[model samples]
Target: MKRKTLREEIFYKGIGLHKGEDIKLRLIPAENGGIVFKRVDLEEGKNEILMDIENSFDLTRGTNLRNEFGASVYTIEHFLSALYIMNITDLIVELDGNELPILDGSAKIFVELLESVGTKNLKEDVEEIVIESPINLTVGDKHIVGLPFDGYKITYTIKFDHSFLKSQMLEVVVDLESYKNEIAKARTFGFDYEIEYLKNNNLALGGTLENAIVVKKDGVLNPDGLRYEDEFVRHKILDLIGDLKVLNRPIRGHIIAIKAGHALDIEFAKLLKK
Candidate 1:
């Protein structure tokens, strides 16, 4: 099938996850086969940086993209995940800062915003990355594997030492229609012990009970509790899906992941690309 791109302009603004600064993002349609990030606030002579696998840099708590010009964009997984799930083959992402807004700490808000504006289809065929061989990576007892498949499917299992989390498994068949309803609403989560550490280190500054699920040693800290029974593992699957989107193409494969995080996710993507 021919690829699809955004049909209209969509804008969002919020605070950055790490920088704790307000940021603005605008998604506009593009007629080609690539995604580009335009740093509109840059001074004269600086050019817009395109999003590509080659530009992928350090995989800390989030995904960061950079170039020799020192221009960088951080925590792009959520936005990229939305785009990938929507099958948006080309786009021009205009941003006024170095990081994407951490709106609600999940891709739900972004998905809603995009759907409100509606999507446009292009006259081109969609291209996908069909796995040709088994790709696997292991770290301790945690591992991730990708095998050839007809479409995109992900089975993620997370094992937490906590009593509440323990071991939970989630399998999602990722597609444009199901992404918003099934995966987008899963919020990112953190441990109660990490709150002070994150704040002191200037990470997850915008996080709150409203945007994320906070788990205490004994149980959940949120009054409303989890949105899903296995929300923690589901959110990990969400993050993994977002991270894998960095490949810049819809993948046709089955992924089995165990206790994987950003680092392992990126490592798996790197191996898949090779």
Candidate 2:
């Protein structure tokens, strides 16, 4: 497959998950720029953070990238997941805030935007990491393994002891169509009890019933119910795909993750890189 870029520029403005501020994002086509983030709010040269594993430094609610000069972009996993599935290898992501907007708390918005603008092929070959052997990494109870495969595959498992949710497991052979259908619409979810603390600490300030699935003890607070019964695990797979994209290539392997989050995802990527 030849390298791909967007057919036209796409734009969006939404609430930033961390800062709770309206942020603007513009996706611009590029020849071979790779997936990069340009912070329009910062000065030139100090405003860019190339989406590379080395630049991935934060492991909180989502994956974040920070440049040498300390310029940062938060919650990029959802957007990166869309780019990987869409096979978008080159583009300039212009952001007018510190975080990508948490649109519906899933990759659906970005996926839709990409589909609308479409893609164009370039002369460059597609970049991918074809694994030869198993790469395993673990952090406490969370772990991930990458094994050889013909295409990108993700097997994600999530476990919560809550009454409404116990265990969710899903394995997906990810492609553009599969991603959009199976994973893109699964919104991020959080416990109702954590809302006050998160808000008090200025974290996840943009979270609400509209963007994320707020879980109560016995059910969800979202009146729309669920998009999918197994959405939780599917969203985990989505996050992993985005985190792996930090390797700066498509991952041609089967990734098995158990209760893994941003921190463990970065650790697994480091092992894959070496």
Clash count for candidate 2 is 0
Cα lDDT over the full model 1: 0.81
TM-score for predicted model 1 compared with the true structure:
0.93
- Per-residue lDDT, model 2, residue 52, is 85
What tens-digit string does per-residue lDDT give for candidate 2 at 79-174? 988988888889999999989999999999889899998999999897568888988888788889889999888898899889888899999999
Q: Candidate 1: worst 10 consecutive residues by lDDT?
A: 43-52
Model 2 TM-score on a 0 to 1 scale: 0.97
* RMSD after CA superposition, every candidate: 1.8, 1.2
* Clashes within 3 Å, all models in order: 7, 0
lDDT of the candidates, in the order given: 0.81, 0.89
Candidate 1 backbone clash number: 7
Best by TM-score: 2
Model 2: worst 10 consecutive residues (lDDT sum): 243-252
